[model samples]
Target: MDPLVLGGIVAISTILVLFSGVSVGLGLLIVSTGFLLVFDGLRSLELLPEILFGKLDNFALLSIPMFIIMGASIASTRAGADLYEALERWLTRVPGGLVISNLGACALFAAMSGSSPATCAAIGKMGIPEMRKRGYPDGVAAGSIAAGGTLGILIPPSVTMIVYGIATETSIGRLFLAGVFPGLLLVSLFMAWSLYSTWKYGDRALLASTTYTWKQKFEILPRVLPFLAIIVGVLYAMYGGIATPSETAAVGALLCLLIAMIIYKLWNPKDLWLVLRDSTKESVMILFIIAAAGVFSYMLSSLYITQSIAEWIATLDVNRWVLMGAVNVFLLIAGFFLPPVAVILMAAPILLPIITTAGFDPIWFAVILTINMEIGLISPPVGLNLYVINGIAPDISLKTILKGSLPFVACMVIAILLLCVFPGIATWLPDAVMGQAL
Candidate 1:
């Protein structure tokens, strides 16, 4: 088969496998292997071992498990819950206070967990009950938690940023710094939206007036200081050039382990075992996807499909913004049903070249892609955030979750436009920090 024909077949196979409810890792492997055999004969299949091993050999990739361990430790220890309560108390005087606090808590949790599901799960458990008890509407409560949970990808130390940086060979520390401003921008947007919504609909009454003495308020600080300290410590280490991103992750993991074991006393034998087990499982799944995607990508290149597509794209005499708009639309549609990781792996190889060819910065483009994927987490039908929130709030139907998410999804759309129009939102921090370093 010709390269273009092989690419076409692989693409179709991948879509079919996903639509058939097969696992993404297995689906990509099957499609890639099938293409290899059809195009290059059985001998090509022998490279699978080397391919898989090479993917795992990456030192940068080691950060995935370390981050997962830190996140799992925080989750199991209930530290996120404590931080949410602290934030709630601090922000409760404002309108839509619970929702605002929820977003704040999620942001803080995002810095710790570097994951959407864990952030959602941690905050949802505490936020939902508090909101419901305070008479907040079910839709609003669920929506806020869902929206806030998506923060895990936007904030610093984000697992998605790490993954993207690794895949593209971008500076991970720079990517982390690059995300800070945009992530905070999204958080601010969410807060503004939540306040407006609450004011329009009328907020629930404040919880019982229990005045905490200054001493009592100060007591809550001890619980949350670790979460904040880790963020500062890692960024400082990276900024000082004392540690690479991977090495920083190892240090972060060690600190988390000690905190769980000594400070929190949450790291019993069973808990440690569970964290290790879960981290290993999640890491394997991620590695499998990366390897399979790598193989499929190699197959596409061998087939010359990317070149043909690039040539066709080059022929179009359209404005750069129009071309970018089209790519965003493609990602948004794909996000409705596909995982962000899959979309990134498959689409980046194709769209990235077009973006560079159109004179856009890859650093900014990566941020744009990150925003698009974050939106995907909340989009309906197959939204991972929706399923996560639904799993936590079982009484709420998927319809309710989707309905609640629509407004925030709108907010995300607006956020994307803001980033597009103002690329500095993504680039400024990286430039400032890296400039100082130089």
Candidate 2:
């Protein structure tokens, strides 16, 4: 059978199964196994154990569970509430200040937690209700949290970055450094949009302003100081060449636990157990998907499907930029259906070769692709962040959350275009800080 035809059949069947509510790991496993059995005979089944073990044995992937535990630990504390209070008190005078503060809080939390759902759930629990009480529009309140949550994976310490780094054999440290500026840029863009939306569309009569005394401002510092220390410590250790990404994640997790137990005094045996349990569940789910993706990716490679597709793409008469645009479009559409990790796992094998062939830097393209995934978190149908917001604020319909996210989605699009036009936005910080691509 033609590889393309077989690839098409595999792709369509996988999508149908996934849409039918099959877990991503199982869906990928079933599709890949079926394809391998039919094409390569029963001997191909033997590769499953090797692929699963080899893929999960990496030291770098250790950071996913550590980072997840760190995030979950912090979420168990009052850190998120304190951070939200601090930002809200300082920013309330500005237009859409509350919403902007939500964005800020999300960014801060994203620095610590590299998962979008964690960021959304942590901040949304506090930000959404407060915004609603303050008479902010439901869509605006929900949208801000949902959109801001996407920052989790784009910021450093991102689990998706770990997966992408391992998948492409790129340096995880470089990917972390590359994300710093783009993450900040997206924060700025989201904040700008929030300000504009509130000023233009918000009901001024209901958008009450507040002032805080210097003493009050100083008092809020204690709530945020511990988190800041953890962020600085982790980044310093990683960038100062003191530790690898896994080491940094371990240190961060320990610090987060210490803060929760000692500083916040919010820790208990029960809560600690819950955090561990939740982290284990999430880590297992992600790692399982990765293991399945490994088998599927191997199957694609074994059949020369990815290479044939890349070669076919290379034969096109179109300019490289046009091809890049097409890739972006495909990713945008895929984001609506697939989660970021799945997208990176499935697409990177096929697209990275084509992208590098066009003389683009792989690190720069990783940043660009990360930004695209950021947008996907807020997009419809399978937008994880949107559902996260709805789960937090059940009264706000998914449609309203989706509506509110449209503006922020536009901000992400603008950010992506800017990154495309001047690749420096994503690369400069990594180059200046690391002195070379890691």
Q: lDDT value for candidate 1?
A: 0.82
Q: What is the C-alpha lDDT of each candidate?
A: 0.82, 0.88
Task: List, residue by residue over 200-277, the lDDT tens digit for candidate 1.
Answer: 777654543234566766789887897679878988998888988888888998888888787688647987899889
Poorly placed runs, candidate 2 (over 4 Å): 202-207
> Considering summed lDDT, which 10 consecutive residues are worst modelled in model 1?
204-213
Top candidate (TM-score): 2
lDDT tens readout by residue for model 2, 81-104: 889889988887777888888899
Residue 76 of model 2, lDDT score: 80
Q: Where in model 1 is the C-alpha error above 4 Å?
A: 1-6, 207-211, 436-438
